[model samples]
Target: MKNVVITGTSRGIGFELAKMFAKNDCRVLALSRNTKPLDDFNHKNITTISVDLSLAEDIKKAVSFVNSNWKKVDILVNNAGKLINKPFTELTSEDFLEVYKINVFAVAELTKNLIPFLQKESHVVTVSSMGGIQGSMKFPGLAAYSSAKGAVITLSELLAEEYKEQQIAFNVLALGAVQTEMLEEAFPGYKAPLSATEMADYIYNFALTGNKFYNGKVLQVSSSTP
Candidate 1:
């Protein structure tokens, strides 16, 4: 069975993705700051780690788990994100850093630490945002969130190139409006065209097989203009 690592699994897409992988007979290590939700689910094939990606110690916990248990990771999904909605003028440096700490820095740190565990044909999929695309429609209060997402997209592209010889694929999914809590936080009352489970289904399939057809690419997984 494929060993999968997914971040931000407390709810929404991450949560659903964890269940999907486990149900499909894949071993999943689910990471989240609050592990209670996943702990309650208690699937035999799923393991939950309490990780606050902003902290180095917390990240080490995840790395330690992988080293101790699953020596190789077949798929790593950097699905954890942080979003702060405030006018650009009112946004402070701390605000930007907080968002980047979780959205950008954490992703890099986790992936870098896990590289040794990822073998040939391993897939690293990062969940980004449509707002990260340069020409995409921009929202009023997502300066920090959108910019951090864009940064990760570039990071994934660079990693894909750096690791191509090893046959590891890195790709970014710039998602559109998904009915996630994060989306609701960014755009209250806005109804998304897709549900978190629907999006998770797509991501689950891609993580298992997208590397064969694509790498170092950002796929825009959006049907609506947001």
Candidate 2:
């Protein structure tokens, strides 16, 4: 069995990923701000750690807890992110900072802390938005969100190169309009081509076996043409 660590397991794609991995008998460490939703699962293999990723201290504590209990991490999914839909003109520096804190900084901080525990041939996948991709379809109100996700892609690429000798694969999944609360919040009254469960299935399989085929790649997943 693999030891999988996933962030943002409170709801949306993260929640589904946790369920999928747990059902597959993976020892799952789920990080989220509120863990009450996960209580309904009641799976012994799934452990929920409640912490605000935006805070460095909280991330340090979470890393300490994981390191104390787990000897090796087979997979780490940096899926915790927030979507703030604000026009470029109205977006404040604080707004950008807030989004980047969760979308980029938190992922970097957590990944850096857990690198020592990652299995030599492990997989690290970060969830980024299609908007993060250069020349992808752009929306009016997602400037901050898109820019932050773009940073995630860059981080994944750089880490992949830096850790190439370690044989740890780093990849970014640039998702497009997954049917989650974040999508609904970003585009009200519009339906997404993919559902959260569908995304979770793809991510689970990718985390399990994708490293064998892909390294330092950004996979754009969508049913519609970008």
Q: Least accurate stretch of 10 residues (summed lDDT) in model 1?
A: 33-42
Model 1 Cα lDDT, one tens digit per residue, 1-226: 9999999999999999999999999999999988888789889999998889999899899999999998999999999999999999999999999999999999999999999999999999999999999899999999999999999999999999999999999999999999999998999999999999999999999999999999999999999977
What is the per-residue lDDT of model 2 for residues 52-123, given as tens digits with 9 covering 90 to 100?
998888888777877788878999999999878987899999999999999999999999988998767799
Enumerate residue pairs that collide in model 1.
none
lDDT of 2 at 114: 89
User: What lDDT score is found at residue 1 in candidate 2?
Assistant: 87
All predictions: root-mean-square deviation over Cα? 0.6, 1.0
TM-score of 2: 0.97
Return the top candidate by TM-score. Answer: 1
**What is the lDDT of every predicted structure here?**
0.96, 0.91
Our tally of clashes for model 2 stands at 0
Local lDDT at 107 for model 1? 95
Whole-structure CA lDDT of model 2: 0.91
Off by over 4 Å in 2: none
